[model samples]
Target: MAFESLASRLQSAFDKLRGRGKIDEQAVNEAMREVRLALLEADVNFKVVKDFVARVKERAIGQEVLKSLTPGQMVIKVVNEELTELMGGNVAKIAVAAKPPTVVMMVGLQGAGKTTTTGKLAKYLQKQNRKPLLVAGDIYRPAAIKQLQVLGEQVKAPVFTLGDQVSPVEIARQAIEHAKENHLDYVLIDTAGRLHIDEALMDELKQVREVAKPDEILLVVDAMTGQDAVNVAESFNQQLELTGVILTKLDGDTRGGAALSVKAVTGQPIKFAGMGEKLDSLEPFHPDRMASRILGMGDVLSLIEKAQEAVDTEKAKEMEKQMRQGEFTFDMFLDSMQQMRKLGPLEDILGMMPGMNKMKDLKVDEKQLGRVEAIVTSMTLKERANPDLLNASRRKRIAAGSGTSVQEVNRFIKQFEEMKKMMKQFSGMADKMQKKSKKKGFGLPFMGKSAGNLPLKERGPGFPFNFKPPFK
Candidate 1:
């Protein structure tokens, strides 16, 4: 929910033109006015907002839009393209050296998550079969080296530290040599940061940049800082000549001003975004996907990628076969929950699907899901494979074991039975579904309707714990 407020406002502005056959100048102007106010309210740079509005208005009011069969949709398309261009038109990839041991200097202010981001970058690189060595170059902050070392261990990357007793500049210089000796492909130098930019900090960073001769100098800025994030990027770019930017806290309760404003302000592409605190949460910044998300169009590619990463292909095929055979036991239910949890939060998954933003009012209590998993876990294997074994006393025992009331266990059992029946129906057309999709994507047992044929309880938006949406 990076641009929760801004996205809602923009969606509302375009609502007036939703069904209009012919988009007039008056309609476009009104929408632009709302867009302008929304961007300003989100703390976007004044100049960036003005220019963006101008560009969007120019295209929106043109004859081409007026001539389109679906002018309303055309106007939104123009805005989406403009928004994508305003934030770097494509993914800015990291620099690869002609020689191995590509050096990257991480520079930023304190609290911008420089250390955590470094670890994430290491993880991202390793996913691509690249060997990376993390350098503990932030000696000024107490325990900075220890923190990087811990992250290095977590990511399974080696941490190169010269100890706090040595200068960071020397540590960075030596880290490159160490990477060369170890045949590591990338050396990430986690440089020191300050509360604010100062001559001392800049000088130290410059020295590291000089000695390391980094292939990439990335400025990590906190996206929640709004305009201040842009200012920080500007300051760092002026001195360090950053090759790209890394935005942290983009997944937090941010207005998303920094993401929209930083590139336009500093003339730098955002290479990566820190989505969450998890080590695997750092993602390559995709401008078009981000623009689509802001407009509530969804990021289908990213969703598929997350699904593919989180799911085991072999296990997925087996699970689908079981579901098709009407053999979805409680054990399978627990396994599905574990796999879905690996795809980050359920809300984030919803945000990546078209029109799901409208269900913003719907909340998925992950803790409640955890409790459901606990209920399944508390069951004995025999009880899991055969629900009939769970008689009154057995249900009471399960309730006690899972730290819940008997009524709760009964409610879960009822929902699971409903879901199992639905899966049987789904199995009837399994071959047809398999033909349509390359393979079956992960399914939520009792969540999100698969289609009109799929049933949703009249009592609530979704069954089981009732993840109710605002709409009926």
Candidate 2:
């Protein structure tokens, strides 16, 4: 949902120029005026906005081939490229020390989600088969230490705490020693946060840096802070010599100006994004993909990565075999739902799916999936594993247990039957598509989502259409 407003406005402005064979100065001027307003409304820095508009105008006006294609598309492409360049032309990877115990110090203001991100980074490292030690370095806030402890428990990472009596620098030193003694692969120090920039805080962080000698100093900033976030990044980077930034609260209603301006302002690559409060919500930053999403073009690679991360390949193969054999039942459906749930929010996952958002207007009854799950759960093991045995009495029992009427249960059964039929029909097509993808070297349909049908679902409850019409 980052840059939702800017995306909507820009898409609208470009919509009017789609089919134009020629573009004149007046038409280009009109589009630029709207774009200017959109950028300002998106809370972009005034100077950045001015420079962006000027560069865009210079290029657009000089391009004499405006008569060949709609000027709006050309402008959109230019804006996308400029935006990508503004955010950092390339993705930056976190620095991992060649030696063991790659230290990463997390620094940020209070309420910036630094402590949580520290735990997330530990988990991320652990996923890479690294033994990470979490050092609770926040001395002021007792809750901060406890939060780190809880996260350590969640990720099964060891936590080092000095019980608020010792200095953060002392705690960090002890933690590094502990990491060295235990042969830990990484040490993530969660440093204290201040309400604002202060000399005392900076000095304390500097001392911790000296003691820890972190390979990566990540400046955690709240993306919801807008331009203030960029300012904070600049201030922190100036003093701490930050290696990268972790933009937290990206799932919030952030205008995305900070995300777009941070690298340009502070010259630090955003190494990771805090998508949610969960431990697994952290994502590696990808500038080009983010630029595409901001332009309402969707991020296909991210979607595929997420699906691959979430889906169990062995389970998928089993399910595919079952579907091909026309043996997929309530158990398989429940297993599929559980697997999808591990991927996180339905909307976020679906949004990444190609063309899944195209049916937003049909109101793809997400609750129906929940209802189906509940109904299946209410069934006895025999009844659930064997759907054909769900007679009238069984249906009534399921409805009562699931807090629905018998009619709803029957409807769900019928829908499941339809799904089974569809799967049977899709089996051959899926195989053919799989072969085509192998030949083409790209994921086939349903491997990921497309952005073309955003605000629309590929298949909704009310609509029976098999094809998505061109949204634009």
Using TM-score, give the best candidate's number. Answer: 1
lDDT (C-alpha, whole model) for all candidates: 0.86, 0.78
Predicted candidate 1 versus true structure: per-residue lDDT over 1-472, tens digit per residue: 7787888889889988878988899989999999999999989999999999999999989999989999999999999999999999999999999999899999999989999999999999999999999999998899999999999999999999989889988898888999999999999999999998899999999998889999999999999999999999998999989999999989884478999999999999999999998999999999999999989899999998998998887886787567657576888877777787789988788788887786657666777787788899999999999998999999999999999899989988988887777666655555454454345452333322443333343111222222222232
lDDT of 2 by residue, 332-364 (tens): 878877787777776665556443433334333
All candidates: TM-score = 0.92, 0.87
Task: Provide the RMSD of all predictions against the true structure, rounded to 1 decimal.
Answer: 4.5, 5.0
The list of candidate 2 runs beyond 4 A from truth reads: 64-71, 353-367, 424-472
Model 1: CA > 4 A from native: 427-472
